[model samples]
Target: TKETKLIDFNQCQQSSIENFIVNGNFPYESLEKFLVCFPKLCSLSINRLVRLNYLTEKDFNPIELKNLKSISFELHSIYFELLKALFKNFFKYIEILTISIYNDNGSNFFDGEQWEDLISTSIPKLRIFDFQHHYSGPMDHFLYACHSGDFRSEF
Candidate 1:
């Protein structure tokens, strides 16, 4: 795990690091810290993030990542709105995006059509999208909606 320590975020400012991955449960504020440190990051993958329960729409900031190409993250529950709002301002150049929402219920937390529209309009260069459910239950309607919305074909 020490090899994953690409930068000493607390000690020095790393503005040149291009790819970063946080594979453990880190606070959402750490992400904000990293964005301030790594302005040229092209890829980011956070396996799990903690302390996001208190997040609100106003908590988001417009940090443009014009060179961002890939992103992957897994969250405990539904936070599609948070993700959308983040991406709307940040990840305009994203090409590959992977999102896994754990503890997903059968109910939809986000509209597939809106996601499709976001992909079409916000991330026009998106080439690969992988969305997964990490819950233990019967297959949810969200899976069906992804297919019905023609999202699966884009990958």
Candidate 2:
């Protein structure tokens, strides 16, 4: 499967690419273009998607890749509203989501309540939500909420 690797997507228009990963810095334009071209993509990983600018309404207007079920990405900071907008735009059918927050601003940005609310409202079909970070404190709180039926009680 080494030959099937898709590193540069500039000239790619493979509709049959079910699994895709962006190995390096990829512009939003290219990301949008590839997503539009790959209509049948079920799993997508944008590990190094460059954050040139904050995503706006115009950027979230794409209607392609409705079949995307699993997505993996890394976010530098907590931008819940931006994230909510992005999720609302294209992730309706997403079942599995893996996000690694590398740069959390501070303690104020680590609100577990907001995350739980976002999950319950935005991605209802989400079966597997994987969150990874260096800090284990927030994870403990999140896990405790889940195990104590606090998360379920909200639903």
Candidate 3:
């Protein structure tokens, strides 16, 4: 029903929808579809109950979206290495980000330094970051140091 509504929305040729919530897959073919369909999109929320296919860096990159500030995603089987550039480039102007993703490796996402550097350098505009991480292994087994301050810097 939701996909149908999205399709039906295509009928309104001149429509410029600002905010979109996607419950299923949005097969962008390439990220260009987001730009072509919703040029004015500011806030985007996507909930993927089932991943039809794994996402890679190539699946990202809809450039010049200055209006897009808030984005949320529910993903599975994603690697931080693969999407590092997307965080750096694709979400350059993002002020708020929310993500719930399942990953097998803890080396990247579990590391506070990586996140701090990424946020400070790449997503400089980021103000609020809400994250839910899911992993298959015992996260405690990973050797990491506990910092004195918050998880932001000096971590």
Candidate 4:
């Protein structure tokens, strides 16, 4: 809290930042406040290391992520609900999407049946679809990963 308080937003003018990296467990309210300072944010990456995190609908009201073009998240226990919220609010013009998931929950993330329609609706301008998810319990992980430069066809 002390560190956050030290960065006075009133003294500093609007920022010109374009990219940001963060931990997935970071509080939504705090992150939303911090990102509002940078109106030009175009890329975001969430490094969720090894921990499994459940998606929290804690009212993530990002100030201005309208210019966001690329997003990458290390998705372990995170769900589609989080992604849907982000896409609805900020990923309208997004071009690149990279995601990774780890656990026995492969089917939840790897089901690509809705990819074409989702891209058409929420992320119409999407160009690259890079994704990976896997898990293993005494057995190896079941996985489906890809880095498709052109997302319109051959998905």
Model 4 C-alpha lDDT per residue in residues 133-152, reported as the tens digit of each score: 55555443322323222333
> Candidate 4 overall Cα lDDT vs. reference?
0.61
Tell me how many clashing residue pairs each candidate has: 0, 0, 0, 1
Q: Indicate the worst ten consecutive residues by lDDT in candidate 3.
A: 141-150
lDDT of each: 0.68, 0.63, 0.61, 0.61
lDDT score at residue 49, model 2, on the 0-100 scale: 45
lDDT of 1 by residue, 27-50 (tens): 554565568788899999988754
Candidate achieving the largest TM-score: 1
Error of 2 at 121 (Å): 2.9
User: Per-residue lDDT for 142 in model 4?
Assistant: 20
In the predicted model 1, the residue pairs found to clash are none
lDDT of 2: 0.63
As a whole number from 0 to 100, the lDDT of residue 43 in candidate 4 is 92
**1-155 in candidate 2: lDDT tens per residue?**
22222236677666788888877555443455567678888998877543445454335574645679999977544455656666776776799998765534223324667667777777778999886644457765565444434223343
Ranking by lDDT: 1, 2, 3, 4
Best by lDDT: 1
Q: Least lDDT summed over 10 consecutive residues: which range in candidate 1?
A: 1-10
